[model samples]
Target: MSTPSPNTEQMTSQPAILDQTIGSRLKETVGQHPDRLAVKSTTLRLTYRELDEQSDALAAALQALGIQAGDRVACSLGTSIAHLLVIYACFKSGAILTSLNPSYTSQQVVSALRHVDVRCYIASSDILLPYKAPVSSSTLLKSVFAACDQDDGQVSVSSVIVVSNGAPNEQAIQDSRVWAFEGLLEAHRGRVVEPATKLHQDDTISLQFTSGTTSLPKAVALDHWSILNNANVVSHLWETTCEDVFVCTVPLYHTTGITALVLAAMLHGACLSMPCEAFNAQQMLRAVVEDRCTILHGVPTMFQAFVRLRYSPEFAAHDFSHIRTGFIGAAPIVSSLREKLNQQLNLSGIGNAYGMTETCPAVAVSTRKDPDEQKFYSVGRPIPHATVRIAARDDPHQTLNVGERGEVLVAGMLMKEYWGDPERTAAAITTTVSDDGIKTRWMHTGDEGVLDMQGFLTVTGRIKDIIIRGGENIYPPEVENVLMQCPGIESVAVVGIDDEAYGEVVGAFIVLTIGTVISLIEDTKSDCIDLRQTTGLQTANDASGSVVLTAAKAREWVRTRLSHHLVPKYIFLVDELPTTPTGKIEKHKLRTQGCAALAITGAIASER
Candidate 1:
């Protein structure tokens, strides 16, 4: 069976279709301010006029190659100005641009290409060279080409255009279907301008693949309205202005960095600083100080790295008074780490963000002036133009009362559908009747949360992550939050293991800071603190009359302070916890390891 082409006319019927898509808006903005810099990297900078002209030329070239609207173009290029231009060109031509992870193995890359049904691929020569099937299957990929090298000497294997003059890899560049990027752009320079077409609000803009805890990663299709609305709402909530310069250290592939930092910055005409590499504490500090950046966005791990650098005299010497807001997302931040950031950076806002890729990357974010509790404990209220409510699990039509935790239902600015998967789409969205027999639909978030009387949203847990010990229910995040408060602990994740006596036993995986074990042991040996003190508990351990509790004893101490069911029965100390490609801990993998050791039914159950 052949794939159905996306209907362009249906987009005009949606009420939420904005005045312009990102490309048209950029075109208008470029005509008005031609000389202004639209994007900049360490080695290159392009004015608005240049970027617009280049993108238009590239679009024309793509059309000449028989590429049309609804076509999927796969790009495996790294961060560069030319790559950004390619994205704009794709948007202008009404084609979907899907970015492939550069680090993906051959098998992973082949699988992704097959899943998206890529028509044309732009990457580096090395990437295309020695092209062997990563998997044993028939793949219908068409044209493949290597992108031009940039001034920085960093090679991008999947870029559509190459800018530098280096000898091409003979083996990879031999395909008759392959062509140079510069030639393609030149070929379409004299072509007639393509008029702007009306883009539907529900038109899928991008497909982001996210790994579920149990199953393989799922491709999330975010529509134009969902993405634009999310960016606008988050920009308004944070009071982002045109004059603000944002320093972004997070990778562009991650949703938080892509939507909240890159896309949001472009929407507001704010200057964004994106380093060519991953977040390095010293390099980031240097960028912030030199760029005169007012806004900073990163993950909790990045902030922790920066705080640790503050102890160095050279790092402490740098001034950070220019930073007005420092936003942290992608991971849970402990109280100590938050406090340290506030003290050292003098941050006006130390915020948190919570959302899945299916929710346009950010459903809620804390403002600069919001209280510390709101920024840390809760993920803040739903942004304007978005709605959140708790609904009964079995009855999707029923709404729960305020302050009652239930499944989270998100509506307004939600995705149009999961691409090529109608069954998944139907399962995710449920139909309901509003007042006066009016029918409506809501996207089931599959998360558990509650809304306060003030309308502030508090996410408690994922419905699947809840641990039921005996008859009592336990949320791993709540326990992990408390466990992270331990003086020597750097990071922790709580999971359920099987037990014969109890249906499941809570297990704590902990990673300590450098030399924390020695420090904790010495502190215990000197009688400066008890075992409870080391684990951040108020009560002492009463496990067979041991004064200094080990990892196992600490669990007993927590059980004494809280309910027995809430306590973790086993504790495994490690150097670091395993994380997914997007930075979340692979809890499903951990649960599998735990279940393999024992026999946890819930952990062993097959999940779709």
Candidate 2:
């Protein structure tokens, strides 16, 4: 067994928690800066007053349609000004908002709605058309005037609100159950709903489904208190203000896009700048220059893509100096990529925000004020009002000392519960009494991490992700972080492959930098089993397909770095690493695909 490192029970700096609903926050912002730009999109720019009145109209219309407080309001509309308005409408009408991925197919969308027990659904024509059209014409042969066909009863949806993308407002759906978003708003123009006083602060206001990195996505129900406060803390950490412009590169449906950026912007009265309906590097870069966007946000992959596009001739003339900082989340940021963003893009004070959806999302955030050593290595101290403690992996009651790795237990501003799944919710949350006799409900974050003496948290990896090779617990991130420093390696994921003798062994999936021309894996008894990949392999086409690094040299690089048991037994070269829709590396998928690939190549699954 590996020697256990120490950790700490140091609580984060607690600040006074704000008591306000989403609607109240919007109302406050409107009062403070009614004429300020609320959202800047390619087609339209909405002022705070315009947004407040417009969203109020939609909320009034929703109430007229019998959508009451606590009702679930679902939207699969792609990123647009209309989507933003819908979000505010849900907040004002006291309906539970769950913004879904617009790219989901009819079945996937239907399944999600059923899961959330949706009452109202707002969808773009792009997704609804597939379900409404015949299988021969579209992808699915489907039904409730294609999904909101309430009589069909697949979901408990009462109304289907159609949002035409850049098209004229018309009855996109012929069913009486359907209504155009523009038409509904027009009818209820100059109207406003009553304050959200009927809803309590702790009442559930939103349902955020987990990205299902390892399994199925669970709907996490967040309350007004947690969601609003989480956004407030993050907005404060980012130093967002009414004059700031935040670029929303990721989908607003996800917590990263919604809580970290969208809600943060709204809470602080900052302008949310949408360069395009979807992420486009060129357009995003142009927005920074044209719109003078001050804040930027993206996953590691998006930043990687940005690095590649930064120097392209089309964007060479554009200036990124206007970008004050950026937020990188969903995955670990490569030191190389982080540096490039800072030096080339002039985003010198980039902050790293870390939290899962269940935690109201901002448990810890690194800020510009932090020293480079602390900010870069750790994901900042826990955000205000977030209490973090490291507990023994085997025993939740045993708190670890500083530097020890264990399950990260978090409290304060957490989700109300996993929607409708009491069993799982109880299993995830545990009531713990401290030595002082104070009782706190701690969320057992499956994430494994360590807190330093100074309280800076460095997330190691997930507890399930720890590879037990020969009874030795090996963290994949430890190996992956080291491999990131190796020559020509761009991105890497480490997984535990099944082994009979040792029980399991480390395996790595590597993506090489584009134009890299080196091959390390050799066909030998002690090395990879007949990779069929020769030396001097190169990829001038794309970064995903690049095959520059080899196994022989890679093994040599690994030999001196990590523990002998930690060295990967197998290394596979791939064009691109598989990721979830939210851009997190799917390690579970990696293990399956890697094993399948070996089986296909007639390799003894285990012998290297």
lDDT of 1 by residue, 461-552 (tens): 77777777876678887777666666556777888776678777787776766545422331232112222224443223322332333564
Position 148, candidate 1: lDDT: 21
Candidate that scores best on TM-score: 2
On lDDT, the candidate that comes out on top is 2
How far residue 255's Cα lies from its native spot in candidate 2, in Å, is 2.1
Give the alpha carbon lDDT tens digit for every residue of 49-157 in model 2.
9999999999998888889888899887656888888888887778989877765666777778888778888876544211133112123213434665556665777
Q: How many residue pairs clash in each candidate?
A: 11, 18
Each prediction's whole-model lDDT (CA) = 0.63, 0.76
Off by over 4 Å in 2: 1-15, 127-154, 166-173, 195-197, 211-214, 317-319, 434-437, 517-521, 524-548, 603-608
Q: In model 1, which range of ten residues has the least summed lDDT?
A: 129-138
